[model samples]
Target: MPRIKSPALLVAESGADREGHGLRRSMGLFQLICFGVGAIVGTGIFVGLSDSVAQAGPAVVVSFVLAAITCVFTAFAFAELGGAIPVSGSSYSFAYAGLGETTAFLVGWCLLLEYGVSVSAVAVGWSQYVNELLDSLLGVQLPAALSASPGDGGAVNLPAVLVIAMAAALLVRGVRESARATAAMAVLKLAILVAFCAIGLSAFRDGNLMPFAPAGIAGIGAGTTAAFFSYIGFDAITTAGEEARNPRRDIPVAILVCIGVVTVLYCAVALAAIGAIGGDAVGGQPAALSYVVDEVTGSGVGGGIVAFGAVVAIASVVLAVMYGQSRILMSMSRDGLIPGVFEKVSPRTATPVAGTLIIAVVFAVPAAFSSLDAVVNLCTIGTLAVMAAVNVAVIALRRREPELPRTFRVPLYPVLPLLGVGCCLYLMYETGWTTWLQFAAFLAAGLLVYLGYGRRRSRLARVTPDADATDAVPQPV
Candidate 1:
């Protein structure tokens, strides 16, 4: 049996051993902020907005607010934990420090769903925009047989597969290069969104906001469950802790800044779209934002512009989310909870080449055949569970290790963590029983992996009684 890893040992492994593994600290605050924005602003804003509106009517704005509030609480918790631990595993690392290896493995398992499934979901959404862009610009469209996901009326989505492969190629180059690419794409996406809001606002009709809470507070709760997915990737900032130029100082700032910037952008875009064309026009549409642009501009030009932006946005998201996933696998491998191959960082590129390729294949195969809705639901449910664990981890750490050095601490302590936990559970309840069944099945598979492999191979089990291994490693503070 393996002994549980202590918090101090976790911190040591994150800083020194992580460097020994070849991860370069090349990302700065700006790059990290870009990563978060790239991940958080993609498919949810461009494609899922329609579903959100259909669920909550005009009051979807309040839903966005509620979701933002929920994320803000968790973001603070992530900032504190990431600063203290400064590890690549995000909430998974935090759980190991505050809870134990068993809990950490479970959180890591959930995050596998959050980041991996999210990459696939965004890829599927990207396929829709690519097909739409072709139809708008060249008056040509891929045949339905080739463009749609299986059982969604098509054989396979080639575009989705291509995009995932492309993102994986870029990631293999190096973290710095990937960060620069993500930053550029994020800026382009933000510019397109701002343009849409500016032009669409001119068509605003106050009447569109009437009966805002059409379905009442219950609708707001449902809307929040969906909108919460929009804020999913802000925590990706914390995953870059080991890669950040100044992990303790920069990671916290980047997390909070990313959430603040994206929250404002989401609310503004939602308001502009609904106020201009009304909720009914946007609901259940595949290209809701582009549709609003076309409606307001009275031509396909605006739609074409939005379609191009959506391509950039969705690809950026896949890049950021995939980057985080590979790093998490790397961390888990370092703990001996998975095969060490995932922990292998290339000497020249300093990136996890083997892990990135593996993730790309996994993401592309399912993305080519499954409907986006099922994977998106899995991402949402998995994320809420991971976040709720993180919130509890923060409280547990505070009580268990008050003397530990922390660069950022959650304000109001127990209050915020409690609220975050409550909010996360409430949203999980709102996601419907079908999603719960899917998440349970997913967790069962993770348990099999843990029981079959992780439990026996964990590094803690290899240490002898007379020799203390971690004593040789310098502690990070």
Candidate 2:
């Protein structure tokens, strides 16, 4: 039989290994919630509203609801597993404890696309908001050649590269500092968004909401696919299992709270955007909310405020998600499935300094030159697949380790997890076929890496090629 990490071992290794390196346990419930909000509520609400609106019209609000529903199911599963098997690596760790090495590797692969590629895409969108803010407040804008990526008809997205660099520097300083930065920015962005919603709803026109769901069921499905991207960061809360002060309780509570908070905010913003300007006006825009604010107030000042908020919001995502990605790599490296440099925590910073810098440089190239659309779909697809694996891990663990202690359990046992899997698959199908092809390519690449390098180097591989729960390469707790 293939090796599967026991839940007991997963818990036992929650502190530092004999080597004296481990993630600092500094995050409280508030910081965990801040990380969740910071990871989410960024590029999606600030920039993606236009694409979703074009697909579902005023029904984009419905799209947000449906997407949130799907996330709720998966979030339940994540809360259950995170509490029971609290560890870094989130879904990848869950899979290792429940499904075995190959599955865990694949989940980690999906996460690479989810976090790594996503940072690049979000950074690209951040450049657009930067240009918007400059034009509104400074009466000057970077030439497209500097602000836009080569794939977007420019030489390089310099702003995107700049944001990634800033985030990388902050992350290398320490997770505590990262969480503080995320929390402060999260508060600012939330307040700005709330203010925008109030201002927009005040001028709401009943006629703008007419002809909702103009594209019907198909449109809603497509729109839901895009809206799911907004919810991507909530799972990142689970990735903080090792660093969180009380992972058993805080992880589940933070997961649920984060999802609820984000859902309400998304629905409010979607409604506000649709009501303030008709779907036609909101569709195909770069910075929809800021544009609406500028239009409603009849001045650039209102837009400038919203744009400034967006600049902060998008920067928070880069910081938080980049943190999540580094932790994921650190966990993988601890398993001997990747290079050891990732797992090497800097004693001064207690962070993955070397790995974070490498990750930044690798993905920064995409942010600097690739098209935003090119990365977005691949990221969404990867996220859906990783989420589905998490749902499966929940079921697998329940059956494999019936005695495992759980601080929280999914409300309906296997039913909700099953639904979570279904929702993830349905959303994947709703996306364009090109995304499927890209995801397939990524999966193939991961398989090659695992078979060629990870399979031979894994600690489990050397432990007689069978179950070695007590002595396999344990993750960085």
- lDDT, candidate 2, residue 194? 97
State candidate 1's TM-score. Answer: 0.96
lDDT of 2 at 100: 90
- lDDT of each residue in 1-477, candidate 1, tens digit only: 223455578767656335564888899988988998998899999999998999899999999999999998899899899888887888888887677777889899999889888888889899999988998899999997887887789999888999999999999999999999999999999999999999879899999987798899998899998898888888888888778888889989989998888889988999999999999888889999889998999999899999999999999999999999998999999989999989988999989999999999988988899886766777888999999999998987888678778999999989999999998988898989998998999899998999899978987656733233334344444
Model 2 segments beyond 4 Å from truth?
A: 14-21, 468-477
Per-candidate TM vs. native?
0.96, 0.96
Ten contiguous residues minimizing lDDT sum, candidate 2? 12-21
Off by over 4 Å in 1: 1-3, 16-21, 464-477
Model 2, range 162-262, lDDT digits (tens) per residue? 99999999999999999999999999999999999998998799899989999999999999998888888888888888888888899999889988988
Q: Model 1's lDDT to the true fold? A: 0.87
